[model samples]
Target: MAKYSLYINSDCSLIIEFEEEISLELSRFILGAKLAIEKASLEGFVEAVPAYNSLLLIFEPKAFQVERLLQETKELLDKTKSLAPSQSTRHDIPVCYHESLAPDLAYVANHAGIPTEELIKLHSQAEYPVYMLGFLPGFLYLGNLNKALHCPRRENPRPRVDAGSVAIGGDQTGVYPIASPGGWHIIGKTPISMLDSSRQNPAIAKPLDTIIFKPISLEEFNQYDH
Candidate 1:
C-alpha cells in the first residue's frame, strides 16, 4: 500500500499527494485514479488532474463537499490500480542534435565524460514516458532520461527557447512544445508541432504517452515539413 494525504487546496479544489519518489508505477497509479474519478462522475466534479505524484481534483464551488468528497475519493482511489501500459500512445519523434540546433550538447557531453555523439546516442536510445503536461501550453514532462545524460539546469534560463527544443533538467527530459522562457539544457530539437489550439485535444500527447527520439541530420530536419 502507498501512503498519501488528501487536503483541501481551495474551496473548489482538493489535492491528493503521494509520499513517494516519482516513478512509472506512481505515474500509472495517479493517472488510474484520475480515470476512475472521471468515470465515477462524482457530484459536482469538474475534473481530476494527475501529475507524477499527485492528483488535483476540482469541483463546482457552490457544491463543494470537502469531507464527504475526501472520504469518497479515498475509497475510490483505494480500489484503483496502475493503468495498463498498452493504452499509452507512442510517438517516434525526430530530433536534430547538430551543434547549430543543440547549444549545450558539448557541455552536457563533457559533464557526462562522453563525446557529443555518444551523448546523443544514449539520449536517443531510451524510451521516455510523458508523465504530465504543464509549464507551458503543451509542454511534456518526460521521464526515464538516461542517467548518464542527466545534468543540472542552466544557470541562466534562456529568454526564449524555440518550440520543439528537446531539453534535460534534473532527472527528466522533455520537448519545449512551444516557444517560451526556459531553464532546461537544450540538447536537440524536434520539428513536430506539439500544440494546436484548434483541436479539441490541444496537446499532441497526453500523460502515459511514450516518445522515442530519432536522431536526424540538419538536412533531413530542414526538409521536414513543420
Candidate 2:
C-alpha cells in the first residue's frame, strides 16, 4: 500500500496519484474511488477516468470549488481504499480463426517462431484481464498473453481493420470496436458486435472485467453473426 497525494490540474480537474506500479490492485483502487464518488452524488463532479495507476477527476467549477472537491474526493478515496477489490462481470466472447477472418494469423505465428495452430491454441486458452478501454471506442486492451505468443505491433498499420477483429499488439490483446485503421496483428475475430451505439449501455466490457474467448468454427461464427 502507498499514500495518495492530490494535486490540482486545473480549476475543474484534480488528479490523485497512487505511488505504486500499474497493476490490477491499482486499477481496482481507481475504480473504487469512482464508485465512492458516484455514491456520494457530490455536485459538480462530472466524470472520472482511471489509468494504469492514477485517477483523474473532472468537475464543474459552478458547483464545486477546488478546496471542496478535493476534500470530498479525499474522503471518497479513503472509504474506497478500505474496501476490497470489486468483482466485475465477465464476458465469454466467441471468435473464429478461419482463413478469411484472420489475415495476420500466419504472420504472428511466423513472428513468434511457432506454428499457426500452436499460436491459436495458446491465445484461446488464456484468460485475460480487461485492463481498460482506449485507442478507440469500446476497444479493449486485455493483458497477460502467453509469453511464447508475444509479438510486436504491425510494422505498418493497416488503413482500416474491420470491426470485430481480435488482434494482439505486444503483450496486450484487443478487439477492434469499430472498423478503423489499426496495427494489431489479427489472429481471429468475434461474431459478436463489440459496440452497438443504439444500446442503452454500449460498451460490452469495462475495467476489471475478465474476458475469455472461445474458439468456434467458421460455420458457428456465421450462425451467430446472422
Candidate 3:
C-alpha cells in the first residue's frame, strides 16, 4: 500500500493524507512535502496547507488536472526529504502563571496530582514544537505538552478568553493570539502579542519552530506589558 493517499477535497482542492499517526517525524515530513510542492510550482497550483499528518493542495479549478497532479505529487514526495529542524528557530516566550491570570492553574494541577508550582515547572521545562496554526486567528497549535500537564478542556468554555492566555486543552498547549470563546484550561498569560496585524508577518512563529515558556512573575508580566 502507498504511504500516502490523495483524495479530491473539492473541484479546486486535493488532500494528501499520510498513513501514520501524528509524530514529530511525520510533522517534519508533512512540512517538507509542503515546501517541495511549493517549489515544484505545478501548473494551477495555488497553495499547500500542511497539518499534523496531511497536506491540502489548492489549485485553479479550471486548470486542475487530477491524474497529472496526483502523479506529480507522488513523485515530488518520493524525491523530497524531511526539512532539517536545525533550520528552525527557537522562541522563548514569557508567561505569567499567576492565579489572577491563570484561572485554571489550580484545577489542572489538582487533576495532575501535583502542586501548582511543580505544575508550572513541568509545563515550562519542555520545548514544544509548532504543529500548525488554525481554528482561531493567529492561534499556534503547539505540541509536546508534558503528560503530567495534560488535562481535558473546561466543561464550559468562557464566553471570551483574553488574548495571550496560555492554555492546555487535552494533550496540547498554546497561547491564544486573540480574544475568543474557548474551552482550554488556562494556566497562564503571556505579555507578548502572538499576533499583531500591523506587522508584515502577523504570526510570531511558524511551523518547524520551537517554543519554550519561561515562567514570569505577575510583576514581570506588568513590566512586559508596559
Model 2 lDDT-worst window of ten: 78-87
In candidate 2, position 137 carries an lDDT of 84
TM-scores for every predicted model:
0.94, 0.92, 0.95
Greater-lDDT candidate between 2 and 3 = 3
RMSD (CA, Å), each prediction:
1.5, 1.8, 1.7
Tens digit of lDDT per residue, candidate 2, span 1-226? 3468999988788998888777787777777777787778878888887776777888887775877788888877777762254577778999898979999999899988999888888888888887667778887778778888778998899999998999998888879989999988999999898997988657898888888889999999889833
Q: Model 3: per-residue lDDT, tens digit, 48-87?
A: 9888888999999999999999899889988878888897
CA lDDT of each prediction against the hidden true structure: 0.90, 0.83, 0.90
- Among all candidates shown, the one with the greatest TM-score: 3
How many Å off is the CA of 219 in candidate 1? 1.2
lDDT of 3: 0.90
Name the runs in model 1 displaced over 4 angstroms. none
